[model samples]
Target: MDKFDKKILSSLHENARISYAELARRVNLSAPAIADRIEKLERTGVITGYHAQIDPTKAGLPILCMIELTVKHLDYYVVLERIRNMPQVLECASITGTSGLMMKVAVDTMPSLQTLIAQLMQFGDTKTSIIIDMPVPPRMPQLLADD
Candidate 1:
């Protein structure tokens, strides 16, 4: 990607709903040119999908927790599949550490968290931590001009 593409991605990361015209103005490109570049970015998988950031508290899922799981056996994919199907599991990643997988979970109540933990325990041992606050929330990568 060139500088213009980098600028376009940076602008879109800030606001995905930005109009093509506005984006073109920011990147100093014609509206149609900007649209074509964006289309190419999406087709090449550089731009994945857009999402709306929601307040978990207002959405009735205030509790957020991180769970580190250690499987009993090496068949981690089996455990991953089970976790993937859970509605409460917001994100899960396989990491290189003591734990096989780490999951970010959101729930409505303490009882709900307990139930979810119980279900996860069926697959392996787990260490969970409640998220008190987010000093730095998740953000899209800052695509550099050099890249």
Candidate 2:
């Protein structure tokens, strides 16, 4: 991507709802050019789907926690598939550490969390931590190395 493309991505990352004309003004390109660039970025998979950031507490999921799971030797895929299908699991990832998998989940009540943990225990041992706050919430990374 060139300088214009980087600028477009930076602007879009901040506000996906920004209009093509506004993007053009910011990047000093024509509206059509900006649209074409964005389209290309999407087509190339550099730009995925847009989304809105929601408040989990206000969404009726007041409890937020992270679960670090160490799956059984043969149950990694099984555990992963089950967690992927769970609505309460906001994010799940395989990491290089003591835990084979890590997940961020939100639930309605403590009992719900307990139930979820019980289910996961069928596959492997788990370490869970309740999230009190996020000082640095999720945000986009720089488009370029120097950025």
Candidate 3:
């Protein structure tokens, strides 16, 4: 991607709903040119789908926790599938180190979390930690400034 592309991406990362005309103004390109670049970015998979960021607490899922799991064997796709299908599981990663998998989960109540943990234990050993707070919020990747 060139300087103009980088500028476009940086602007979009800040606000995906930005108008093509406004984006063109920021990137110093014509509106149609900006649209074409955005289309190319989408086609090349540089720009993935856009989504709204929702607060879990306001969404009725206040409880947040992370689970580190160690599987008995390498054939853990079944466990992975079960975890993936769970609505409470927000994110899961195949991590290195002692744990084979790690997941971020959210639930409404303590009882629900306990039940989810119990179900997870059937697949492997699990270590869970409640998230007290997030000091630094998640952010999009930084782009190089256009010259």
Candidate 4:
């Protein structure tokens, strides 16, 4: 993509709902030009989607835990897929360490977490840690700034 495209994406990433006029000013483009660029980005899947960030606690899920899973073998894609379908498993990823899968779970209480743990145990050995506090979530300027 071009410099204008990068600038547009960066601005949108910081604030998805930014007005077209404001985005144009930030990227040094006209409003219509900005619109065309954004449309093109969306069509090409460079800008796949926009989302809102919310607190799990306020959304009826008060407890959070990190579940570290160890599998019997490296071919654990099937297990990962199963975990992904679980409602409690809000996020899942394959990490480059001891755990085959690292997952974030949101539940109503500690008992709910225990139930999730029991379900997860069917796949492999499970190690879990409850979230005590999040002073800062590693939300880096997730927007790709223009070079």
lDDT of candidates 1 onward, in order: 0.91, 0.92, 0.91, 0.85
- In terms of lDDT, which candidate is stronger, 3 or 4? 3
How far residue 56's Cα lies from its native spot in candidate 1, in Å, is 1.6
> By descending lDDT, how would the candidates be arranged?
2, 3, 1, 4
Tens digit of per-residue lDDT, candidate 4, span 65-103: 899998767549778778878998888888888888899
TM-score of 2: 0.94
Candidate 3, residue 53: CA error in Å? Answer: 0.7
Model 4 lowest lDDT segment of ten: 138-147
Q: Write the per-residue lDDT of candidate 1 for residues 1-147, one digit (tens) a residue.
A: 899988998898889999999999999999999999999999999999998888887899999999998886766778888888999999999888888889999999999999999998888889999999999898777555583
Candidate 3 lDDT, 96-120, residue by residue in tens: 9999999999999999999999999
**Clash pairs for candidate 4:** none
Better of 1 and 3 by TM-score: 1
Model 1 lDDT vs. the true structure?
A: 0.91
- Predicted candidate 3, C-alpha RMSD: 1.6
Q: Candidate 2: which pairs clash? A: none
TM-scores, one per candidate: 0.94, 0.94, 0.92, 0.82
Alpha-carbon lDDT of model 2: 0.92
How much does candidate 1 score in TM-score? Answer: 0.94
Between prediction 1 and prediction 4, which has the larger lDDT?
1
Report the Cα lDDT for residue 94, model 4: 85
In model 2, which runs have C-alpha deviations exceeding 4 angstroms?
145-147
Model 1 alpha-carbon drift over 4 Å, by segment: none
